[model samples]
Target: MTAFVLVSGPFTGGEVWREVAARLEESGAEVYPATLTGLGERREAGGPDTGLETHIEDVVRLIDGVEGTELVIVGHDYGIHPVLGAADRRPERIARIVYLDAGLPQDGDAAVQLVPDEEVRRRLLDPADRDGGTGWIDPPAADGWQRWGSTAGLSEEALARLTGLASPQPSATFTQPLRLSGALATVPTSGIFCTESGMSIAKLEGLMTLGMPQFKALADPRVSFFDLDTGHWPMLSRPDELAELLLGAAAGEGHRLAAAPAQELPGYLRPFVLDVPEQTRERIGRVDLYLPADPDGAGAAGANPADAAGANPVDAAGANLAGAAGAAGAADTAAAPRPAVLFVHGGPVPETVRPTPRDWTTYVGYGRYAASQGVIGATLDHRLHSLADYPLAAADVAEAVELLRADPRVDGDRIALWFFSGGGPLSADWLSAPPSWLRCLAVTYPILAPLPGWQGVDSRFRPVDALAGAGRLPVVLTRVGLEVTEIAATVEEFVAAAEARGTDLQVIDVPHGHHGFDTVDPTDESRAAVEQAVRSVLGHL
Candidate 1:
């Protein structure tokens, strides 16, 4: 059975979580609201002697007494310190930690040290702990509820509820440093950002963009992020929303929000959205660029490849006909242009410009993988639905190719195009008349030939017919064995034509794999095969 342990912030008690607890209990969950020593009912029992360690011990005892196998530990405000300490001590007992408007503490980091605002520390924290003082920190003034983020829309009821139950915090909880055995990192963590407070997704992303070390953990992809439009005390102002978010976190769907994966990009990778000019302003095709940072982590190198005038277009054009090894050797330079791969995603719709979460994750994952292997990964969206027919779809690919070739970080002479599923037939022109700079063409379970229903469109959509003009452009084709016979026949026809025309093509058959194996199965075998496929393309590049 799964149990939840909710810990309240400084100068607050577990009573603050009364409403949220009630909702979770209604869901048949075993919930425990922990009141640390020197706070809530225990205020009179604690004095100067009550330190951070005592608070940690308080939660540790509660966890030990709980009658459950898995635990979802929740911490709010200053309560995060003791909760993290307890989690480090008992990692296996924890299923996940849902932090509510709280700053995370590292192994040797103190609670006070985690606060980014110096004014808050100097005004509230310092005065309370000075010269071995009463070891108690006073609560914020009632008039400053907005600054404290305790009230959502400045409701008198919410403010009265907050100040009514507020108590003095133990000074030791702020001064004492937390110690971790590195077990905390292994545990799955989540966060609920009170957007009405000072912590917005944009602010967090800004910190990540600046590469600030203090905010590193918040940038982790594994830690799901959520936003509540209320103040810091959502339980008091918006209990239903808070309860639903907590329940979602428990169900492991907290990462469903759009802001969840915004910070998933690594520090070494610079991501930007490129708008395709030919499309409508509202529905223009967009391409995402993930350029790898240089070795020294300064920024992206080879971003100004267009500035290098040494590249000869004629030489690259001639290299297309020269066989794989010859073409690869011809483009070699002392300061070679960075290799780039254009990613085209597949979907049921003919033209898909904005990919879904599954598609985005898969593309970004492949992009990062390509960057790790010393190549640029670019994901492009094409006009879908009404304007997604044969010739128009092919035009979208051409525009994306032109954009990649024009990028400063890309070697205009060393580019590869990867098509997935429905996108296979649209790139027939590239396969038919292979370009000198087009190093490799890779497709995974693609619709190589037009289907019977789509024959009303132009004949140029037929990829197998274009194989005669493919010349010697190196190709990597991944076929899923479990695919339907129609698609299988298309793959077979493309392969046979490529062989007959003497086009340099490599075929990889995943007999036990289904379509979108990487996204669906994600097994070790699938991962290894994808890596091998990428390596094969890179080898030809």
Candidate 2:
């Protein structure tokens, strides 16, 4: 029997391939399904912060465990990037390639950008897609999965596992184009486009024509193409037929697959922002700031991508504030002078041009619940340690603080702050030395790496010397069940570390079955507990 390796796309796990695998198995072919870093239970230490190389390693590792020269890579959705890298690295092992209704990656674009149906593709993208240096689209819900993915055959377990997959894909893949040294040409590549009835016919047509012209252009020698009158998910829609097509291609039963039908072009401009360099007065230093206008903003709001009824962030907020304000192109509400919560978003150098209504845990769906809390949420784009000469991300935070204080609505005196992941530590450093008036802090999953090795600075959780002046602030340490299994040993570990340092710390292990407890829509119990945590901190503030 021939051995095949099927790789599932984003928001899915190896189990998603079961139906297809079972079908192939019934037909006498052995199948090994591969899941990427953050897809299924596979969501590991590496996320967007981990790049294309990580994904390549993941596939290679899976390949090493399986013994077969008859290896065929069948990549679906986001899985295509790593599969190419795998084939690029291990051409000898691959017998043939099958792209199951997936986009062909380019040297300079990520999965999201690779698709040509700009308007239709953007229709699914959301404001939660923050720029984490890797150009990642925040992982959306099942609804999002359906937007670009064919989900006909996804199992209950496969769909259930998605809720646990946390962290927006680290953005690097989207920003950094793959550097294919022409390795893809060596493999006999095939694109399988599933033709669905209710599917976006016009959109699929655009994907073939404008979205993937290279596939069409490569009409001759190396690459092969085919179309199926099936749903988005062939494995579920027509698994046996799809399996036969793959096996037949492997056995050379048909000629090179023909290109699917093409349709008219669709208009689009992904809402992305660029980080142009900005220099300080007196030529102090040059820093990059992505003015959060548009990923490619057209000066004004043209149309709301999310439906006015379903999953629209504007409507989700119960008021289309961003929509209305954007529609009128109203000036940004002048920032307040005080009562501010300095928010330093993830990524060392941030391009969080998009905003999420909910916190890290999307337990309750994406809601702007943070802004509604009567706090002046200050989200800033900070340059990373690499970009800054002195490695002072705090400087950028401080400057942003000043900018916020400069606003009439902000109260600089009674400042309360919140930081998630490494942003907490960076927030602490800025609060310790600066002239800004910061009173309380709530840091979630603070990164403690820099403090230990930072020469000339006392980062060993030192007290009394500078930042806090021997005064302790209420600290909340949170950890999800998964983080303990993966990295930290529950939220108590952080609390214990803080206690040993003589710093007061309150720990909450947010009794959620999954990780990323802070994102919105945490399961009912976990979600309520997180809200309680936030409320307790608010009381302290």
lDDT of 1: 0.68
lDDT of 2 by residue, 438-520 (tens): 66666554443332112222242222222343247665555555442212432344455555666655666655433334432
lDDT of 1 by residue, 238-301 (tens): 8878888888887776543223254554321322121111110111134545555566654444
Model 2 collision count = 37
**Model 1 misplaced regions, further than 4 Å:** 114-120, 123-132, 202-221, 256-541
Cα-based lDDT for every prediction:
0.68, 0.49
TM-score against truth, every candidate: 0.47, 0.41
Query: Which candidate ranks first by TM-score, i.e. highest?
Result: 1
